[model samples]
Target: MSSSTPNKVPSSPPASPFKLALCQTPVTLDKEENIAVARDYLMRAAAAGASLAVLPECFNCPYDTACFREYAEELPAVGFKPTEDHSSPSLKMLRQTAQETKMFIVGGSVPEIANDGNIYNSSLSVSPDGTVVAKHRKAHLFDIDVPGGIRFKESDVLSPGGSATAFFAPEIDCTVGVGICYDVRFPELAMLQARELGAKVLVFPGAFNMTTGPAHWELLLRGRALDNQVFVAACSPSRSEGGDGYTAWGHSMVVDPWGTVLASADEKPALVVTTIDLGRLDTVRKSIPTSQQRREDIYRLQSVP
Candidate 1:
């Protein structure tokens, strides 16, 4: 909601506009082909003049719990770049694509093998120079049972992350918060990113199943955008071929500060490109001023020790 923005100290205001691309490509069992497909789409997005490009959750692997560990990849050490000798194939591709395209990339969510021998659903924001600017392991592991509708437990194989994640994206001149699918359900994380970290744009790479997608996906995104007074973009993979026990709701979209859908894609493999300006967010915040009216004396929402 207000400070130094997502990763770096401010040099100027994000009062200008920039183009964003959301790649809603289809996920397949073959990891090599998936990476290749994402690479091709990302290059096209850059050619289309997007300063930033995003991919869907689990773009490199299947979404099922049983398949997590099988496709898990060890991440690079902090402050280091991924390489053929040190990084997973997926990360290597991401780094290469970011460098090749000269565009900031939100690599969506992937299964990561941590040092503790646990797997986590993680998202990474890579700069145009191929540096990993931000990394967010999902803080909220979705464990929902909708009786006859759906029952999936991410906690079955994934460990929850411990902190909020945001970074100052020099490419877009704003602090951008990165969150995976289930993390979008919790407003606390978004509030932390927007208020505490000064994130102006929040990106969520989600894969909502048909059972929940049509009912709440867009509504949740719109709510987050409206309440936080920030731009929000969510990317979802296309509906699976055989569904592989889970079929995604393929509607990747972007919402404005006023809860308006700027650009969106239906249930098919597609690319969505739209322009975003932090100037609009500033206008909304100036008119509403909810960030200044919070009664912090009564209660405060903050990170717990």
Candidate 2:
């Protein structure tokens, strides 16, 4: 792997000093087509020496709320076999592909049908050996009424995830935090990953709309990185079609501990790959001591209402 020079373009330098890939692509209503695209991107990312690859939220189905009920699926059993045209092909294939690639895979977030029959926006992190190492249900669902008259009431059809989840990826030599699309807007979740779970890198597979993506996507990502002093990777869908003209802002990105945009893909169907220097995390943390400098004692002194 070649060393990544600062602010350069179109060059595959070494394995990012520490490397990860964000698979940013557009999805239509076709689940099989999305699976095929996901498989191809995983191949591309693995070939590029990325130890981890992240896809967008609800990659297997359209981002519309109505689609969840029809598209949601049960978690596959151990050694569960899926038919060629399985209704939920991406989840099955993702587990299989991670083992096949021998790389840690963050399978983004998908709409899953829980045993209770409630649909959930879930994210899965698989080990190289095909084990489901970590799973995060999106704690914060996207329930908003945009100014454009577009509305998304995730609770209408999907149940919210109750806890934060992170997993250790031996490839990166640290615990990795996980989040979904709307979760990026909540800093406490990121803090739970970094402060509570001691995650060195935080991954959020998002599909923010043009309404909020431009304004909050990068800002939320950089703020998490800067405040937490950890690497942040934001993956987004390239398109959306539902709920009164919703459009996704598709600039998937990787930010370093210093909040620098190491690599970012344009608003199109593409992949953003970058290296994270593990050493840089230590250096930044040592210099700023932001994580260590927090005064919980002082905050506790605030008068209780």
Candidate 3:
């Protein structure tokens, strides 16, 4: 897909059919530099005519346990009010960039300092007006100890978020669900968004290491897309060589409602732009009718309050 200038004028009612961009960019040790790179990519995505752009998890800082505290900053209060100190560079830049580019931006997961002094892995969805439309903290902490394999625990430093998050995007005229890295492992989150909230797309800004990425990244994405019949988009950081810290499995991709990979990026820094056709979503759902076929009488999934 080609990049095009963003539409400046807002439609009284959002138009149907829009492009989505998955920015699989490289992360660096430098926080400010990472923010700059994210801004540049957003510009490129907007130029590509993407009505919405998504960043990978922890785009502004190194994804390490020790680095979380060092890089963590106070995010805007839950109501989208700016923090008094305005300490979070990532949040500030994201709001500004969304407004300037006039595009809905899924600001990827960041290490956020909550009011209670606990740190959380949080993501924010910003509107073209720069207002925060949705906020989600990672509900599932990535804590696994595979013997002879990678064992890292986010619960040691981060707090799990409480509720499922899905927000309506006026530009795309669809609801989008937000999730972090480990949250993708839980199908209930995506299910709730699709079944209850009527989300057409579930966006997960994840960072899967070499160990799990190759094994489960694509599998989980396809499963979610197929199960819910909703578009699934996962954005990951560009894979880097051996470093002192974690090595992400890059391969950012977008899967259509039919569980097909519409576009994918290799283990390199790049912008993946794809047009998400809602018409196709309807066609698939109508043909399959899985939503109607579900035997809710036999078994029902409950939601957490």
Each prediction's total of clashing residue pairs, residues at least 3 apart in sequence or on different chains, is 7, 5, 5
Error of 2 at 150 (Å): 3.7
Segments of candidate 1 deviating more than 4 angstroms: 1-14, 82-85
The number of clashing residue pairs in model 1 is 7
In model 3, pairs of residues that clash are 3-47, 3-48, 4-47, 4-48, 4-49
TM-scores of the candidates in the order shown: 0.95, 0.87, 0.92
Error of 1 at 269 (Å): 0.2
Tens-digit per-residue lDDT, 1-305, candidate 2:
00101111122232235569999877877888887888788888888888888988878777888788887777653233323224456666786788778877888878889888988988777777776677778888889997874577899988987776777665557678888988888787787777666677899998888778888889989998997889999898786445454578899998989999889987888877888786788789898986677788775222111
**What is the Å distance of residue 280 in model 2 from its true position?**
1.0
Global lDDT for candidate 1? 0.87
* lDDT values for all models: 0.87, 0.77, 0.85
The residue pairs in collision within model 2 are: 1-14, 2-13, 2-14, 16-275, 18-276
Write the residue-wise lDDT of candidate 3 on 1-305 in tens digits: 00111223333453488899999989999999999999999999999999999999999998888888888887774347433336568878888888888898999988988788999898988888877778888899999987777999998898888888877776677778888989999998888878876678899999999899989999999999999999999999998797878999999999999999999998999899999887777789899999889898898877765
Clashes of 2: 5
